[model samples]
Target: MNFIKVYTLTALFSAFTLIQATHANAITAPPLETQVKQVAQWFTGLFDNSQQVATNPSIPLITLSSCSVALTNTNPVTGTENIYLEQKSINRFRLYSFSQENSAVNLSIRAFDTNYSVTGLCNRPESEHTLDSSKVLATSCNLQLLWEPTDYIGNNSPNGCPTSSGGKVISSVTVSENGIDSLDKIFGANGNLLFATPIEFRRVDSIPEPSFTLGILAIGFWGTSKTILRKHKQKSTVSEESLFNCD
Candidate 1:
């Protein structure tokens, strides 16, 4: 009976430790604020096709400057941020709003046209990086991005974003710590590919990769707990044998 009790207790303890080990190994995503900030940081940079254009000169000299502006008033994500991206190649501008739902992050994009052409807007002060809600157009196709290992990839549904010319647009964007990849396709009403621009860019200013945080979280606690639990089981077995054998 005593041995049974001890064995049962040991088993329960082992199970509890295993649970801890599992929790330690489990990848718990960061809080919404932290995650939003991280994505915003990845997007806010001067990205140009310096390397890509060198290899294929045909690729357009696309310089994308994105900056994050903290929302103060009536935005969907008022406290988070609104990302403003200016494409220097074609004098185009875009606005992005981000929100989090569970483990996924959503990106809401809109084509913004101010009264005048805006160039080098990202480099300006934070106060000047915004526009009134009137400048924001309504495009309901929000890209649901998933963190695929090291990159966030997402695209709109088929014929989701429509062009003013009554054509359809399929847009895809990838955000990575290294850089950004974006491709936009405008299909005519007849399903013919009218225009497509695939742009690959590397951050002009290099930044440290934040993957080490996940590596440490995934390996640090569970590994130590697993080792200690194994040693503990071995010691407990040896102690029990010696205790019973002693006359």
Candidate 2:
């Protein structure tokens, strides 16, 4: 009886230890703010858009070098903050607004013609007529980025965006540790596909190594705990069978 009591207590202690270890190893996602910031940082970098024109030869040939996304200031009136300014060239730029909606990150893109200058009769003075106050040339499709276990998949609204070229543009982007994949489809007013292509941009930089190391460590700990628990269970079962046979 005493031996049985000792064995039962030991088993209970082992189970408790296993539970504790497993709980500790469990990885919890970072706060929404942190996630948004991380994603924003990931998006801000130089990219090559040459592949876009390569995949679709019909599209007008544009300068593909020096494509980049940079952080910008928040809007004061409309509160429609400009999180990232995506510059394709001296003439073409896209202002992006990023926000956290529940567990997902949403992106709204607005096209701008940086080459154009603001004329008089505008609300802001000529001195303040910068890209921030520049008229929105076009509003692109809204994009929602769904977070996966390892990366993010993004899709644009099917409604599409009307352009000055008398067509609508639809876009989708996928972001991962490796890089970004972007797809853009332009349809004419008659609903004829004008230009469509997918472009892959290699990452110019990577996320901090400490976060990755922590994730790896957590996975290892969880796996080790599971193995330990399984072995403990097998040993407990064998010991119980031997004790029963003796009895």
Candidate 3:
């Protein structure tokens, strides 16, 4: 009787819990490369906030230009999207390296603004597509960006980075299909998070390609999600039956 009871407990526990453990392990976040491509497509094209500045006199007038580039970086990171960004007269180049653990797309930014040769290269069609990666100096992980469901938001990491004036400085950016809204959340003299002054940018160029791609990707995700749920439910049913038949 004791042997039978122990055998039943061991087999029943194995039957139910093992399948669940495997299923949980099977569930994985979507691929990072796909999200990176999505951001690249969305982030392309020129943007400006002239209308916002017109309404709010206190707000600064800003213009932004961004285009994707392919760099032969010495410290190459897989699945990184390189982009050239210009805001007013200050322009910078960045390699946006991506990773994913959940629904969010996380990235670490590597800037190469010090490489002057690549400056203004974003304008040339052929140049914007490739770069002399050997000339660009590798930069530290200065900031982090995250793609939320509807938009991408950026924030400086760890403690706020230092500045030339000995104060901390940080920047945030929100990117959507139609516009880019940026706000640098500042802290008061007392070290609390203060009000943020935003600089918004509306798209200056059209991106029909990305819009169509986004639609296709959404449909694929929906179908894939439904299939996964159905499979797991079916497996659970089979596992339950098997456990009952244990002798």
Candidate 4:
């Protein structure tokens, strides 16, 4: 009877451990590459269509430039969307949520002008799309962005901006590349979290400052000059010794 009881207790402990492990796997965040790819795929299609429209004399051309992600945060459902101009000026594009009406949604924008801190959540549209399960979840994981070229992001008013239909509600926000740079939580429906973090997106077309490249070249030239000088000095010394020995 004693042996049977001990075996039963051990089996119970093992079962508990297995159950916890399975739960953890379910909540575990997906890989950063996967997350970035998902975000990119969505935007790639959107941008392609937008760019074509922009070329049309009657429509605006919106091109996506760059994006990044953060790897850690307690909740991965929220973060900032940094917008860049023609691969030049960086700023926050105004945000609109696409979640169920009164489904406890929180959205905000932060511009680098004020250290890229979230200024405030834009006025809520009367109606918005509730995020389907396909979107991401959990914050401390991967964050992604799909950019649209904006000659005038503030005024151009992209087609997907928030509207009475809840245009682009943030289904899941991720901070996968860098941790929260800054945060400010405010009250919202269903005790939802309302906060903003500073994020940056470097444009690929933007010309890089030359100081770093120039410094590397300067060091290489200096080292070559020293090597030549040392060889010359050694040759002169050897010649002098030969002359003194009167070979």
Best by lDDT: 1
TM-score of candidate 1 relative to the true fold: 0.65
Please give the lDDT score at residue 239 for candidate 1: 14
**TM-score, cand. 4:** 0.20
Please report, in order, the local distance difference test score of every candidate based on alpha carbons. Answer: 0.54, 0.44, 0.48, 0.23
Among these predicted structures, which one has the highest TM-score?
Answer: 1
| lDDT (Cα, tens digit) per residue for candidate 4, span 136-245 | 22121111232222110111112212212222212222222211111112213343332222222212132222232111000000001223234434432211101000
The stretch of ten residues in a row with the least summed lDDT in candidate 1 is 215-224
Q: Per-residue lDDT of 1-247 in model 3, one digit per residue for the tens?
A: 9999999999999988999977765663235567666665666666666777678755545555655556655564564555554445222344444445355555444444353455566567653455556654454334444656576666664354443223343555666777766554434335555334556667777753643212211000000122323443443211110100000
- Clashing residue pairs in candidate 3 are none
Worst 10-residue lDDT window for candidate 3 reads 216-225
- Select the stronger candidate by TM-score from 2 and 4: 2
Model 1 lDDT tens row, 91-190: 4566666677666776666655446455676578756765566656654446666765577777775735654445566667787876777766545667
- Model 3's alpha-carbon lDDT is 0.48
Total clashing pairs in model 2: 0
TM-score of each: 0.65, 0.51, 0.58, 0.20
Window of ten residues with lowest summed lDDT in model 4: 215-224
Give the better candidate number (3 or 4) by lDDT. Answer: 3
